[model samples]
Target: MLLGYRASEQYNSYYKPVYYRLAESGGQERLRELLSQTPSIQIYDTIESQLSELAKINNPQRQLTPEEYKVEVARYLDGKDPDEYGVWVYYPWSQKLVHLLDEEEFVQVRTSRNLYKIKPEELETLKTKKLGIIGLSVGQSIAMTIATERICGELYLADFDTVELCNMNRLSNCNVYNLGASKAVITAQKIAELDPFLKVTCFTDGITADNIDTFLGTGSSQLNILIEECDSIDVKILSRVKARAKGIPVVMDTNDRGMLDVERFDLEPERPLFHGNLNEEGIDLTKLKDLTSQEKLPMLDAMVNLSALSDRMKYSLSEMGKTINTWPQLASSVVLGGAMVTDTCRRILLSETTSSGRYYIDFKELIK
Candidate 1:
């Protein structure tokens, strides 16, 4: 016969069970065994116990609830010294915590917090706004920033490219495991993991001229912001034109030494200066499309001449290929630029004016 009994320790209330087994031979032996088993049952107390019983009682580790975490974040943001409360150890990035320990580095954190405090309305506005981001290289940074801020109810991610090894340097939410996955698909999966309720629409093929109308003009297109980070300058311009035409403000962040060229084409007709110049009266997109590469060069030269753009500029354009490569200089620039873009977008959404224009931040000057 075998029996088990559940038992708990009086000190900690931790539960475990004790087991007993009995064996039988002959009838007389079995009766003797049964009688002896009760008395001879070696109560081998096989119970496990923690070595540091006092520590276990005093400091039991438990995860902070979401609300508790949010409250902590808010308090930290409000300039409360987290280290004094001993809660700063839990959050490594807490500026208040860092400041309390290192007074020399405290000023920078305080300044950053001051800037962040200026956009209180942005936090609320982003929760209800919708944004469409094309190209996942630099766009991933933008998406992550937006998601971190808890803004933007829905996000539409579009990219035709797959996660190549070269993209690892700049693209967030990309890993070796996602190397061959479509950028849009991987980004959507990552965003879903971050916030299950975030409405995400992924287009693996990306937005083309033919599908651009459907993407931005459909009944589902309620986007408040359109971010253009495509590899192709032509596509970037085209996407901006389309978004502007649809009355959605277009924001583009270029990695020109961590500088941002923000154009708010929130015009009634949503016309952008680039489109206005490119789509001039005599321009023929269809004719240019039909021409071969060899034939297109001469036509492009003629068009450049007709458009009155300088020969030097035209030569520079010819020398610069279409694909925007991510150099270390540009990668660093894009990150800084993305942060500025996020701040600017927040200001715009909140209807606050914090000076808007094509702002450039020279790293050399910044370092100096």
Candidate 2:
């Protein structure tokens, strides 16, 4: 499920020239770091091949057997505890071994693209922040993308549903084995597999009115950013209410035409909820509970924008349970949504950009 490795930071200069000189000086240590990735030399096909690679580090010259090779390799590990071999990390749908880089090295290797956009000097700021993601549908991808890039040092995940056969359409990492497993458990496990260093707190009970305050951080610590993807309408509005009071930003992806909603409660304490789209359409938010499939259509359209909604979505709503049992969701749209929201969260968190109101990430608009 995950590939684990030990990592250490090998560079720290603010400038490239000085950093390169420092990295060059620690060249042998870097090589040892790279070689320490595998379980042991036994995993190698032949002892000669293992020693051949390690021999490059030998100052003079010496012959050694498979047994002696282990001792020689340990010398360059720089007193790293022999007890820990590698740290396991799971990145979304697939898994693989990557260098166990130090905090700086990991941040550098993982988020190079985030540089310039997120100034190198400002990288550590992201790690100091905490982000919370609720609902595992699109939120799972958002969580993974955040972890894959080491966006935040600590994360809080909340999801109550379980992986069902129907969920496979969008929840890609979950397979039969994960069926019946709570979404929060699944997401937390996935996050653990990806980067053990990332601190995660799971709310398996889901975010409810009762616990929303704690979720928002009742203690001294408050969430820096909140990504809400819950299905309960009450929780949706209530969460925003709490977020506004706490001055935390909220982001949500609808997975339709790249539709995303940004509520900058942190910036505007009195901002209207969901841009007041529901009220504008004469839609009653209080009547959302227990509505029939067809009855819910109008509210959905208003929440996501009616006129701009895709023809396919309009048709799906018209049919309700007739043609499709539920709203159609393609994996492409979900993943695109995950990436969009995560990128937006990154820009907003880093102060590199600001987002609010409603925006369409429709590919149709981008290409033509």
Could you say which candidate leads in TM-score? 2
Full-model lDDT, candidate 1:
0.53
Give the alpha-carbon lDDT of every model: 0.53, 0.68
Q: What are the per-residue Cα lDDT tens digits for candidate 1 across 1-368?
A: 22452211121111111111112125335434444655533221111111122222323375555565555455443554332221111111111111121221222222233335745455445567788888877887887776555456778888888777877777756777667667776666665444434567776688777877666654445677787777654465567667666667777665554445555666445444343434445544334345555654444333223234334333545555554333232456557756876777777777675333455566665787
Clashing pairs for model 1 are 126-151, 126-152, 258-333
Q: Could you give candidate 2's per-residue lDDT for residues 117-145 as a string of tens digits?
A: 66766678888888999888788888888
In angstroms, the error of model 1 at 274 is: 3.4
For candidate 2, the per-residue lDDT at 65 reads 69
- Stretches > 4 Å off in candidate 2: 1-76, 79-117, 280-299
Cα-based lDDT at residue 39, candidate 1: 51
What's each prediction's clash count?
3, 12
